[model samples]
Target: MTSTGMTGTDTTSTGTTGEPGDRTGAHTDTDVAVVGAGPTGLLLAGDLASAGLRVTLVERRPHATGNLTRAFGVHARTLELLDARGLADELVGTGTTLTRLRLFSSLVLDLSRLRSRFPYLLVTPQYEVERLLERRARAAGVEFRRGTALRALRQDAEGVTAELAPPGDGGAVTRLRARYLVGADGVRSTVRDQLGLPFPGRSVVRSLVLADVRLADPPEDVLAANGTGDAFAFVAPFGDGWYRVMGWDRRHQVPDDVPADLDEIRGIARRALGSDFGMRDARWISRFHSDERQVPAYRVGRVLLAGDAAHVHSPAGGQGMNTGLQDAANLSWKLAAVLRGDTDDPQALLDSYHAERHPVGTAVVRGSGTIIRLAMARTPLRRAARTAVARLVTTVRPVSAAVTGMLSGIAVSYPAGRGAHRLAGRRVPDLLLAEGRLYELLRAGSFVLVAPRDTHPAAPEIAAAPGGVVRAVWANPSRRGALLVRPDGYIAWARG
Candidate 1:
């Protein structure tokens, strides 16, 4: 969700924002300055602050965000990320989970087969996730300045300086400097514009209406979805009585500004799903468009981008918000390491943020685009063929497993260097430790050296070599080798 277009100013020449800090000639006022307090920035800021870095989060919106609902599905991988932060179970309790997702009326994708503890998609409002993250951030000492917008940002070898416009019109401009900056400010990011990054892609669908309503007769399935040649519709419970309904009509391809009504949504649902399930009494309704755009690079000098600021996708597989949260998971630890002087080459480590995440962003953009295009296939013959092919492919166990893995993001991985361990760059499954589980240990937000109980006596020292890396002994000593798992639950290094 973009802000009502930023002030479109880039006054970086003189740091005269009428603040005393601006006249101090200091290299940096804080460790990190994060724009946008959404899921991405909140997670990043919380992680950085937890790692002892001073972080400031800026949000253009007021503290009271009314009915802020968007992005309903949280995939398995994203849930695992939250688990590492000790928030997964609490968040899971606030939403409903569906083990299977139906597409095009037939061809169900089974999420129950996923290996993750969270093997299903969680159906929750975007605000629920944000609320939890914002609470964690506040507890971790993240300075949040609501009703503040980033007017401009200038980066140099030393640090980045940001020009901020405060709450009201004619409010005095403020200057903030930090060692690094991040743009998690959604699609229309002012930080991105100041960096001159091009978000190159086009809109995938127009006039898609979203609403939270009550179903007079709820569908037996946890989720209901189908796409007729002329329209597409999906409905899922919010765990509350309210169900989120998304529908699009081919005949009514109006602009996003056009007000959406229950009548229009009911017509589209009936056409696409054969029935509206007696939908009634809408709680919220809005019209919008979906796009598949991504920035060329996620990093530029001292500034980096995450979340919708770096990439955005069609709401086809519900990957938009999950991907952004994962981006924060990938970048936060690396940034903490660099800022804490845990790395020899900070630039190389920072560059790896783009290297690892940009490819994932690209894949999500393409995958979501393909799913949306196929859902909107015009001809009857094409739709039948797609359904047939989908059924056939899904019947094959490996193909179905692969499909679910990618869609749920459990199969996502970074590149390993030459001669690296096979486990390196791969996701580390939740292993049983002597005292607890792998994810529980990750709540410390540090590297974890998981060693077999029979490993060398020096294993503890080796784990300690990485500063705060925690040493975990396997409950099953029969397992071989020692694995170094990153804070994000990915294997970093392993030895037989």
Candidate 2:
């Protein structure tokens, strides 16, 4: 998902583009300038524009994009994030949902018992998520300028100035300025490069082959996958007749972009899983490496990076896209607050983003790396031991529960001090409210204070204190609780 290699690029000092506004001296472009139109940037652009901020999303490519989606599984927590934005239903409708996570032939992790409206992982393409987000962004009035490569960025105490190498050959570099900027470019991010932030990690594996094909006769386990001591192979349905085939042969450690063939994938599958489930009629094939890397810092001055630009991991648990989408949700509101001058300490609010999200990104890298390495164990004895341990954990209820929660992203929570409200910094479950679900209220893109009529007299004062930015809603008198739900559907504060 890297577009940094696009050609027709030139960055000169004093070439300007875009028709300037009616009243402007230095041509301040928009309130926020977002580089890269991936899922993270799309979500952030939509949220900021919906909040009435002038936002422009810049893409290095010339068009919207095709179906070359790399990530597949949208976990329960990511579905919850999209649900809050009123887009999850459409995405979930197009994708298949699985109640259990198949780790191997013997051990399957059940997600049916998780406490979420979306209790299962939705098997959908990364582009499907992007389409829904892009639609919302267009409706919210975000200016999308494709074919514009962000060449350079400079930031001061006021705002950020962006230099873009325009579309065609010998295209002059256009200048844009905004109150804030974000780099959502994938793995080889140009924005991250300009900022000089160190992406500190090594490549985990190279030349991992990926294929989309049809199975003549479906296997008993559609997510049929295993590591055969020397290699690994996995098969997951595309919600259509096609299935995704991913495999890595430890012996064939070749370079990426060396044209991959179908026979190579077939051989790896045969060696790893005994048979390839009669796979044929390959739709497409390619190769890529898994990297376990994280940026030292997400924010540098007025610029911040999200999505693959900030962190990348082995796509072991299908967490890459979900983690990036969640990162967008986490950063959008804080950016809106700071840009609109709603927070007393804007820098502190901005700093909170890195403080809160960096650890989550780190945890994801560690977990995914561990899973991939475990699957890459070479010896026969070690493979058997892993399978045995996996079976044992699956048999233990709490162990299985913990694994499901962590993999599905529901187990994540922030650090909130111990107040009387126990739900602070916890993900608020989608409650059945009189109007709709708790997430339905979050579509307003503001903090919602939901209180039982009998329990919290201070709801009125809390809303009043925040200058009505905190919206107050009431439940039945006997419900006996109050919850201040953040825009992201996490409980900021709650009382029972």
Candidate 3:
């Protein structure tokens, strides 16, 4: 996996199997080229490769680790997706679980009320998640072209072609062609730029400080956040010996790149929190502003965008990575189906990704924006009113559950048509039948038909469906009714 051997120079070799990433047949390889190796890209690549599609994940960086991430919360719906892939247990084992989220002094989001297998939110940094997903992608035989940047992207009705830059200067460029190209690249995406898509939004907040330091005493809560009228602060642990602290001061409206020292950050934390909790050992420190931005379209012919390339907003509920992960899950199956010609109508299958995900991405941006704006209340009266309304909403059981559901993504559903069945578009719960949990059945990477015991061999005709379309598995007839569950755990077309 050297740059010279890969995209740097026109050198190719053929290898048998279980190799890191080998060049075969010399010319540009792969059915699909993924522009980024983030969560969305890795998940989509893993699913695509596992489905026997040639996937090449192109990342600008040589290695996946070392980047400090602000993402620490994995919601219930995301946990269910991970469970389907058999990766949830490992993440759950390594992370801390918190039943509630506190955005302000008098406001708390109760997550335990959410009706799901994983009611509590898992608090672990994004690096842990990336590590696991990268492992899964590699095991799926997805080729990784690291230390190479996508310099240009162009596409036609047939396929996409990309020009890539080498790791160092004065190096020769390489050209790769694929049937489809995905821009999972970050905010400043070259793929998006080449396609001339407008990222329409403005910066929400600025001069926010981030520090992962060792605290003399960590808070008792798994996660904590508080906002005074003038400042805001939040803290979450890495489950190791370090803590991630984020805060911003409204009084100091300075440039984002202005160098921030520990003393200034600690003072802001002290204003937000009663004490800094002996904040010391400033291991990592940086500053960034939250923005609310989304592209007008997710798909343009053979090119599609996902993750931060598609949308971005404030990290109020830690929904950025989770939304991107779910987006990957939603788009992967559809893309694989179309690429493999598994579906009857490939265009419809491809269009459904945008129809379903664009609205969801829009909702996330709005929700996250609301949270950040409410937290940034400039007046004491407004802050008090926001706190009161939030607390009151949590006091009511149903409202609290709905709030948690929104934040956790458990309440996400698509349009199932005007005369659709009651269960259509609803998320199928992970039922525990006599054999095993329902998500265990989805581990094979396909849709499934769960029916009563009498229907054990009912779907024999569909059991060996091409591209793992659908299979029938019997559940407890008395408790759970027959249903058709989509690969992402949503009830596509079901009957009670």
Candidate 4:
């Protein structure tokens, strides 16, 4: 099969299909069928195919039209996930890292103080991430069907059958069968609609303008953001020659279909940010509205939803894409295990996807909503309160840590099982191993068992507890006994 790269390159796609004993009478064309070739689906499909499962990714958009600049900031935890897949360093080189995030005119958050290898948010276009993930997915043999629209979907006890509309008008429809299907489509998700799921939320802000332009005179700060009583503006570098500028004007609240002239954007930016920095020569511009919406359930029987398909929020914290990427990381391994028959109770394992991620999605929606609301505070008292809160978050140590931890995604953790170790379900920091680092050990895309160095000689056997778990030893040989790190770099289980 032919696979088209995001850079408009051509490649071949081939993958091995898994045949579980449970599929007695039902035969699937692929192990997993993924809709939407965005970052979430690409990562999930790549991980599945790397685990020796056949994955077919269907995308409604054409390959050549992949340049989307909606999301620009990649948070630290997302960089760590890419590190596990050996793509973080390369991605980092492609963009600028902003250690200081300026909000409102005076308040600043120091991202460099975050406790992680990637201490700053990387400013790059969303396509850069898609480019890397698409390469990996194609190299891992994930079949890609571009310009194919999902028409209908049905799931039986055995598998999911997806009816797809091929490229071009009035073309013949095709059907693909798979044991599981994932909808990583986007905020306007067809799969979610097909599942009859209601996206419950309200539009927080409207008449928001976005543009990528060549700034004749750039701002001194890597990132500049501020919100006046009547307008708000945010500016950041794309690392290329162009920069991303977004703003909103309360006085000019027009419909989204109205054309956003460069002059209007510059006027709003100058009013909110003090200066437009000679913004000119726009390459792309659009007016949009942001809504805080999420699906009630991420998983429904054999079909699951991810990324924007599962949740969407105001782009206040720059967590939209990062949250989706993490969602894929959290769900991909469990799906692979169930499809491969590594787990006995597949339903429980699949159900955990919704159980663990729904709360996080809720938190993201609320947190981002809070930020955007504060930024758009119009009343004098509310603006004062916003300033006070910002000051507390920047000055108070505990408050700063909490806010930064949640925003940077380093402090996010899932619920541990009953009587489990304290570290269980928490993200594991990259520790120095005898040979390399924790993330390096995860490049194989499987569970990793890390034992203290110089432990009992049977440590390797303990690591090989069942399935395909990789073994590693701590470089310093601490008092900690053993830690089973999930493929996504969370503590599955730990014994001290």
Query: Residue 387 lDDT in model 1?
Result: 82
The lDDT of model 2 is: 0.79
In model 3, the worst 10-residue window by lDDT is 1-10
**Candidates' lDDT values, in order?**
0.82, 0.79, 0.78, 0.83
What is the per-residue lDDT of model 3 for residues 230-251, given as tens digits with 9 covering 90 to 100? 8989888767777878989998
Q: Count of backbone clashes for each model?
A: 0, 0, 0, 0
Name every residue pair that clashes in candidate 3.
none
User: In terms of TM-score, which candidate is strongest?
Assistant: 4
Give me the overall lDDT of model 4. 0.83
List residue ranges in candidate 2 displaced over 4 A: 1-27, 167-169, 418-420, 454-476
Model number with the top lDDT: 4
* Candidate numbers, best lDDT first, in rank order: 4, 1, 2, 3
| Sort order, TM-score high to low | 4, 1, 2, 3
RMSD of 4: 7.1
Candidate 1 Cα errors over 4 Å, as ranges:
1-27, 167-169, 457-467
Worst 10 residues of 1 by lDDT: 1-10
Model 1 lDDT, residue 492, Cα = 71
Model 2 weakest 10-residue run by lDDT: 1-10
Q: Per-residue lDDT for 374-462 in model 2, tens only?
A: 78877778777778868876899888888888899898887664333555677877887766688888888887778764344464324
Expressed as tens digits, the lDDT of each residue in 1-496 for candidate 4 is 1101001111111111232214556778999999999888999999999999999999988673366559998999999999999999999999999998876675788888988899999999999999999999999999999989999998776788999997567778989998889999999998988888899999999999999988888998888899987899999997888899999999998899999889999999889989989988998899999999999888777788999999999999799999999999988888887777766545556666777788999999999999888889999998999989988888898888888889999999887655566877789888888869999888887778888765543433233322467878878754568877878888776776
